[model samples]
Target: MAGSEGPLRLRDWLVAQIESGRYAGLSWEDADKTSFRVPWKHAAKLGYQAQQDAALFRAWAVYKGKHLEGTDKENPSVWKTRLRCALNKSADFCEVRERSQLDISNPYKVYRIISEGTQGPGTILPLEGQPGLVSKDEDKQSPSRLAQEGSLLPATLGPSPLADHGYQAPGPTHSWSSTLSEDFSNPDFWLHVRLFYGTALVHEATVRTAEGCCLSPRAIPANAAAEYLLGPQPRMARVHFPEPPPGAGALRHLLPHLERGVLLWVAPEGLFAKRRCRCRVYWRGPLAPHRARPNKLERERTCQLLDTRRFLAELCAHLRAGRPEPEYQIRLCFGEEYPGPPDQPEERLVMAYVEPIFARNLLLHSKRLGSETGP
Candidate 1:
């Protein structure tokens, strides 16, 4: 929703879009499937002008490598869906016609927009480079206004901007809540960890890392570690994971310990501990149900980066075979991210834990992590 805006009518936006398309080298029938997506530029521009949800229509960059805004998973760029929404409500002014009355006549599955004015509802706008079918109100514009509008047409995306701009596909029809505040510890909570590979690398690197990581075993040794390549330039390190004991079914569960995540914290400043010393919350299962406390006996129990990376590996596996809804989740506390390494550096460290809700939200901050947890 556009914050603080009054009520909206999809028809108004549709009228503006029709006008914008007319100004753009507008056409009715796309000569090929490739030409059909061209109108989305007008749809996106109108979205911005109307103060519509930026998530609904992410504008295309006129030049390469300029980051398009609004990159969250919430309300994905659905300009086409919005366009169809507006068109469905604007039947008096526009009509959608499949390329032919008989489906066999058109193999492309492309539909054309025809104006109510040109030849009633079925009248198509002239093909590109031909005279456009202007609406009655557009006749009021002076030649200079028309010229100014022409300069406003956006530069087209090539090599297909559909991938980044989302011009070709619709956002998913069903999803779960993006927020995570409530799911709690359960007997089944740690059955699987949700991992999100680092995001500091180029989008391509993110892809490679996730693909590379998803190949890990269903569960790793308690001390399992692997050398993963992190690159802006190559950076390598071995990260650790907890192995589930055998006979765990299609899923490998966390050991009875290490459930809510291995906590990385420091003793109170007056405790006379070493400089920058940190303490880990040992995985106290059901019997000793305390979150943080004075230590009892200890075993070499944790490595910080390893816990983070293990979650990453789980994410990859989830991609290959997880369902629409799974039993665990990955929670991301953006401003309240986990502390990474013993130094607990200056930037906030967001975390991904495998919980009752299987989430994959915090992959963006993983690459910057550079230290280890107390073992």
Candidate 2:
């Protein structure tokens, strides 16, 4: 009996999760330990990706900083003077030899000095008769004079140019919908907003085709506000999600919400009002619910109702089992009261529905144990 409380304790918890937008960790291994019969492929895949993505992001950051392009190096002229002074003070009279035979094995070691100083090598020593070398006449000039020339040395030392280009790290390729309707013909100024989950996320960014343009990037920690003023554009504007809340990454669960990216119309004329002046969007992406084939048991019941509460409760029980399912799908709805236009007295009700489905589609073979031990 799959009711509010029954044999499947996990099912009850799932009901609560659906209503409040919370999820319980359900992995295949945990399911095995808990002794439930559900398959583990979906949950394992989800956990694997989450872990991989985290590692990839960290690697990308370190690589990017270490290989920053166009960043000027330490001025060579400064380095030369600094190296010369340090070598003169050192007790080892191997400065000139060390500089001439620069050990490539150790880049961090003290640099050698090439000069007529007592600590320098005999070959480069200031001479009464070395014709083409630092001649007797040239020795008259002070070290300070030589230091000035060192400054002109080029400052481009690091990774090869090809290694430092901005290449995006590897990950699952996302297939965006063709619903994007960027107006290529419009010559007048138009602001574009990249929206997702029935809400304008990035905000209204100003667009212009003129010299000197910039774009700002922002992220929403949580799903809260909309209609942001993302200052004027032609600027490369972007919106990023910091960390997805509860059920975001799990596609099987949240597929309905991400069915289509949303859009909005933001014009400079009414920037002050922040009103829904024009152009309401209605693009939708794929949804798990719409794709869910009804269970054969419920085939005849066309009006079968899904109890939100029961689902949440069952979900929790499953998570508590320890070996929980890797993924789950939960439904959510949002409502806000917006004061309509000045002429319209009533506040408009803005409603949005979000559904998230968790699926561990990419788990490693070792983690996929349910099949080996037939449930």
lDDT of 2 by residue, 232-261 (tens): 222222322223345545422332332211
Encode model 1's per-residue lDDT on 1-375: one tens digit a residue: 213653333433333433456423223354442213223332233333323333223332111112344553333233333333223222222232333231232112123333234332122334345354333221133221221233221122112111221111112222311221123222111122232222211011111111112112223322322211111111111112224336633223222222212222111100000001122222211112222322221212211111222232333333334522212232222223233345654232222232311112122111111122113
Q: List the candidates' TM-scores in order.
A: 0.17, 0.16
The per-model lDDT (C-alpha) reads 0.24, 0.23
Distance from true position, residue 361, model 2, in Å? 3.1
